[model samples]
Target chain A: MAPSDVNQGSQDDDVLQEAANWLKAGKKVALATVVSSWGSSPRPPGSQLAVSEDSTFVGSVSGGCIEGAVVTEALEVMESGESKVLEYGVTDELAWEVGLACGGKVKVFVEAVQE
Target chain B: MKTSMLDQILRDQEAKTPVALATELATGDQALIYYDSATGSLANNPEIVAAARQAIQDDKNGTVKLDAGEIYFQTFNPPLRMLIVGAVHIAQPLSRMASVVGYDVTVVDPRQSFASPERFPGISLNHEWPDDGLRELDIDRRTAVVTLTHDPKLDDPALGVALRSDAFYIGSLGSRGTHAGRTERLKGEGFTEAEISRIKGPVGLNIGAISPAEIAVSILGEVTDCLHAKEKKAAA
Candidate 1:
């Protein structure tokens, strides 16, 4: 007999639903999903983050480490209407710039929501 | 991803159906993969479809290397469930612990007094007879059933229904002697030895659990083990 709120789908479902709602309201949306992870990555594969053109976002693909960079890339995806895969590891120079220094690696796929 | 595909994923989730979203990284094309059917851009690729099916079975998300390019499979499965038949002392802690681990739990008992909301607080409760309650729940492969009531009248009927369903775990809380008698009665009811053997009597893993809370821990541990074992076998 968990509470009603506890039964409300899952966190990932909520993120997708939010993206859909944003799209229906005429806001360009992009979705980023963690395709794979290794080492001590905080989030697992299938973790999602939804971003709108207004910089509004929902969910997370990492433990507050690479979200800002992902949002920046998501806006670009929304503009280009093309999907892209991004990889980050502690050993990468870009990872150091993005602060994903948790001794883990993650690959994320970012795609724009087609109308 | 197409808006229509996203809508379909939400709809399938609402219907509690398992699905895998397969995305080809190179081209950004996507497909929705069901157990026996496929749709969307990548549907025509048999290798991607096969890999999607494997991902769904393993209940894990991973990328598959294909001849054309790598495809990432994101599996969406309905929540797991645990149904406790007795609503007894053990059921109280077991339900809460199972909920913490993401099991949608429901406590069933014919006696309304034992299944009271005050006792269970925020949990789901069913006051119907055990057999009737289980039938209404429509136990599926992702469900676990545990009968905690020591009464033969209640536990036996529940066990009969659980054995016939696709529940991944079926356990009965009882002493060895009590379980022996229960098995004899089940045999008398025409249940085959193999079928009756499915019940993990004495329920949990043998951690020498003494208290109700400790016993709850043991049961949840066994349930988790069974679930992972199934996944490991599927991955193999």
Candidate 2:
């Protein structure tokens, strides 16, 4: 898909639709939620985006800090329909080694969406 | 043969039943599901199917996005909850605002003085202790909790619950001084430096707000900021 298409579908509503498409197609899917945020947190507690088996991006839990990780986590839940919690900051190593440079930390919970 | 989840939320809203939206953020199959009081945790209810269709239609017609064909929010199980820890002055307006924005708002407080259905107007009122009351409401990633009470009696316990609970947007209302006091109290109560940091003190954007209504706007603004910032990062 083109970058523009990805960008265009990145809206929250559109992203949800992508997830819905996957569910309808009987593909394993997962949902990620931002349970907590601190510092210059990008999203609030309840902001959401959906993704699908194809890695077709839809919604977002974090801006970019952990999308890669979230995708990986989502895949795991998608298959087993289990729920998991994740935490992230500006930089993974920095967040772990020193502290969150952005001052805020976000906790995301990923779960397989049972439809 | 199907009503959409979005449609069910609408129906629930109209019927004075509460419903929440669950969106998936990563690359995996995502779908929207509604939690109902009766049917319990079933997904793909007729309402969900219909609402999903309408939500997609709204995206197609709405200016948010097009050309991308349609917009679908992710799918998740029921219990996408929104819990407000205080039904204080600002909460009245905040509840109204959240509803207009399509959030299912539950006004919770142990104080009868602050939490009343009359004061909250269209919002759901829960007159239970903050910690205990949260049990009735769903606290999850898709759920956002905001504390509108400035009283320690109300705010502190809610913060304690929120810190340990999974609800998102755990913010309290107060000035810098009040927030500082809260920090001290949370620390005294044994919250780690890290946990206390999660609280958005002097809550909302520093937009020089002074009224409950204005504060409501600012609070939601900050909440959106939290929401979009994460989304922006994810997209990048």
Candidate 3:
């Protein structure tokens, strides 16, 4: 599928629908959901992002501090068809570079979109 | 399977009913859980079904780790609704304030003149009698009913319907003397003291509000307080 399809569907509705659209378009997709969040997290739990095999993404797991990392992880999960839970926090080594300065933690669960 | 579950969830979202979808992350197996008596489980797992039902009742979304696998319970409940029983002076600002705070506001008054779109601007208005209007609105636990008519004939029937339903907040505009009289009437109509006490007479937080707008603020504030107060109780 074209990268524009991913972009267009990203802002359409919820992340689940975006992922479903991408899948129906024959795009390999993975889903990243914020399963948990600590203090000061911009989005609450159950927030999601849809990531295609081509690295295009939709929605957000963080305010903007961690989408790139989640996309990278999601691409890897798409390859292996495996689910993994990733954690990000202010105490991480790359926290400053990722802009997680609000002293909070979030856990994102990423899985290959397979029905 | 995902398509079926997603379709069901989308249907439930459109219908504005509380629905819980649980997915086993490991196997990608999913189920739709409805707490209602019929067809309660889709995944056929009792424990997971119970967890989903509990999540819906608690009005929360989270994960439940079972021996079978980790199931993510995605809950979709409709937005709260505020039904203003009278298109009186207070409802003008109250409807606006309620909408600002994320309530699907609907004003019901049989008086067509008072219930005009000119008075309410963009609100959903019902020009039917109070009881019939409330019946059509289908009050639920996520609904809040406020009667501002102050007229016993209009307010009483609305109050009877609201009190018997599962509306989270039921308030009526009246003074202390009026409330006392209302209590007697409700008692005479077979309402127990416990049920009658649920009505917040002199509706709204006692902020000494004077103007209609001020009273609307106090009422919205009290409605918010009631909502959160219920949440606190559920959390505890």
Candidate 4:
């Protein structure tokens, strides 16, 4: 079996459904997906994190190492209505500051869900 | 990502339909790619459409470089499935183990007493004959077929159907002698040796397993090995 992760198949479905429900409830939502990963990454490509306007989040892009930064970018995406990609690697200064200490790298895409 | 598009993707997922979402990085334009159709703003881009189709076939998420920038293809495939033909002792632990590994499991046994809701709670149970039940379930490439009955009456019919299907893994629980007998039977029934070779007889890894649960572990391990064998080859 593939390495176990909290954000597996069914959980991913739940995240997307929750994002849709939050949208129906009048909350702005942004979705962050791990577009690519390299080395001992906590999550594989396609792992996702859904964030609402108020910063309520579901799912994960990493073990919890880079979610804060992703959520921060996600809020900006919700505001701007434009998608953006963010890259983080253990070698980056920002990555060290954010504590992605697992010696892995990931590229995340953040986009707003428009009606 | 429009709410309607997201909803449609979720609907496809619920229906176990394989789909891919292609997003153009520069413009944030998106397209939904199905096996034979494409939709959304970037639907007309032949390059992106082809790449999306390839991604779906590969069952992998990836990026395609374009002159403009890049297109990200995220594939959503249906969960893997396991069809256990016989609610025997090994089936009990095997079903639970397979479920934990993310397979949508179905237990098939014609005997109601063996395939009871009590025996396989929360499992999809089919009391039809093995061949009929397997036909109804519609085995696909993502399915694994395991015949644990050991009884030729039950296991043989299931093996017949499974051999003709596209199931990625096919196994029968038995000894070498039993498997040899099975090979002869299948040959008499007109099955080619190559086709008969696909069944992993004396099934599971040779881990020296003796107990039912231990045997289940070895089978699951072998199943996992077969499931990822292609990717491992590619990586190599």
Candidate 5:
């Protein structure tokens, strides 16, 4: 990882700034931030993902396993304009489905990119 | 309001100022808090400001709950700093390695010739006295000070200021006997034995390093260990 990647916030901030620009351009957008995490997750709590009305996306929440689901929910959030928190846990059965080999829990807070 | 808040935050980050963003998750309300100024439009809530400021001082990021709501206090601090008080052979690799690992490194020495831009390109070079240079830099918890110049005139003054400040790690390069002499000198300079003990003489972990580059690696390892240890303690 680059030195900038170590802090995660700085990297996420750049993504958020880009999202804000996209929002200003009249593109509907939603932001998903990992508010909390448990066990040996690859990404830290402040990791982020931004999704747009056109299905454009930036950043990552689960590295891979749950991004597709989060982006799906983010598109819905952009349409509904209601913010929600999402929880994903890697259980034996769920892991098999999501392709997550490790056991951990991550809670992501999703909200519309307001203003 | 949202545009300006984000703008101010980006500005602060560009200036390397310490700041925090407090968001009430329930309501989606947000505020940008500046640590040094303690000034923000964050709902005029003293509890939130206090909590956010504490997190800023600690330089750690997390969320906290209050009667008002669950506020996520995300802190933004300046990059970690490494002040090497000698522009010597060890510092060449040390500064490069430190910078690679995300530290804003500054090499200080009174010898302008040694502290030239040619010797250490792409790094901040300070040709002022060690003590004055450190004072100008304003050593903080995020900074680590290491004095590689064995000359008392150079290293002692740097050590003096570092011991008094909150700089997380302080190390001096010397042999065991030299460190003993330095201990006595520091005692004469009015530092207590406990304070003097803070100086990690024979600096770096005991990896039996001999070459200057190898020594730099050892020192970097020790500095990294110290930083992580402090983070662990704060988390606990």
Candidate 6:
């Protein structure tokens, strides 16, 4: 995922903004931002997900778009307090495939938020 | 190694202060805020919030240290809001759309006849005239206002207020000719051409919309474009 190009007031952004508030309050959080989009993706660029210290969920990186994948990524980020980006829509013949119905690809940039 | 900021953030969330929660979701930290339009305050701000405002010169984010808290406002920026005027038809869908994007949207209008909770359902409906009503509401540096009502008596006065106030995006509904007339009126009212230029008359994007619902969607697109104008990608 590169970076958000279009700014949307989608649920994902709202949830992410909420989490940003938590971060300002000195909370340890992780952000999953949909950095890319393809075809008819539900969550577009700037869509975000905020994960709390105890694995609480706020916002979403995908609108049921690629959630299962994002949750797993959140778990990893939560464990190590590390921030990183992961790209979706990568097609592999051998990899387990979940067809994002939008036929559009979404790249979620997940970061471990820290002061 | 402590969750100092986390606790404060949770409380802010509970207390309904538009707390911005940031976490590392991927490569870098990603940020989001829960804005409480009612209180107009960020929940429990870490000491850093103050320092950010002071040293950073950009209240968006900065760093400082204080007791019982850790520094975490060291990310992205502050909150931005969406304000929709004229609780008429298009305001409904746009309100829904803006909500998805996390805007603490406020709909303003003087006609209580149209600006009722029953009409809008889940919006922050403010039954005040644009010129008169805006003063009480917080049309600050981070706000964007859209005037959907075509009637200038309702729309023009509000535009006057929004133009003077700090609303980032000031839009109004009108046809090309109507927009020109509105501009003439505004100019007649002693508004500068620069200020008049701030408005997106004939509001909504160029979607060639015909229906009210479609028009609402298109208008919302324009509003989002206005809100994200700075955040948009370079013409790729």
Candidate scoring better on DockQ of 1 and 4: 4
Q: How would you encode candidate 1's per-residue C-alpha lDDT over B1-236 as one tens digit per residue?
A: 98898888989878979899999998899999999899998999999898899877767787777986988888888878999999899998999988878788999998999999988999999988999999999998889999999899999999999999999899999999999999999999999999999899889999999999999999999988787674346434
lDDT of each: 0.87, 0.61, 0.79, 0.88, 0.80, 0.63
Residue B136 displacement (Å), model 2: 3.1
Pick the TM-score winner. Answer: 4
Sort by TM-score, top down from the best: 4, 5, 1, 3, 6, 2
lDDT of 4 at B12: 95
- Ten-residue stretch with the least lDDT total in model 4 chain B: B227-236
Worst 10 residues of 1 chain A by lDDT: A1-10
Model 1 stretches with alpha carbons more than 4 Å out: A1-11, A24-26, A54-56, A91-95, A99-102, B88-101, B113-128, B135-140, B160-166, B171-222, B229-236
Error of 1 at B224 (Å): 3.4
lDDT tens string, model 3, A4-110?
Answer: 00101011135666777788888888888766666666666667888988888988987888998899999998888878888887845653455356667777788
Superposed on all Cα atoms, the candidates' RMSDs to the truth, in angstroms, are 6.4, 15.3, 7.6, 4.0, 5.0, 8.1
| Residue pairs with backbone atoms closer than 3 Å in model 4 (clashes) | none
- Tens digits of lDDT, candidate 6, A7-26: 33333334645666766766
Per-model TM-score versus the true fold: 0.73, 0.51, 0.68, 0.84, 0.77, 0.63
Native contacts matched by each model: 0.49, 0.00, 0.14, 0.44, 0.05, 0.24
* lDDT, residue B70, model 4: 84
lDDT per residue as tens, model 2, B143-186: 67888778898778878888887655778878899999999999
TM-score of 6: 0.63
Candidate 4 displacement at residue B168 in angstroms: 1.1
* Stretches > 4 Å off in candidate 6: A1-59, A62-70, A73-115, B1-7, B13-79, B233-235
- How well does model 5 score by local distance difference test? 0.80
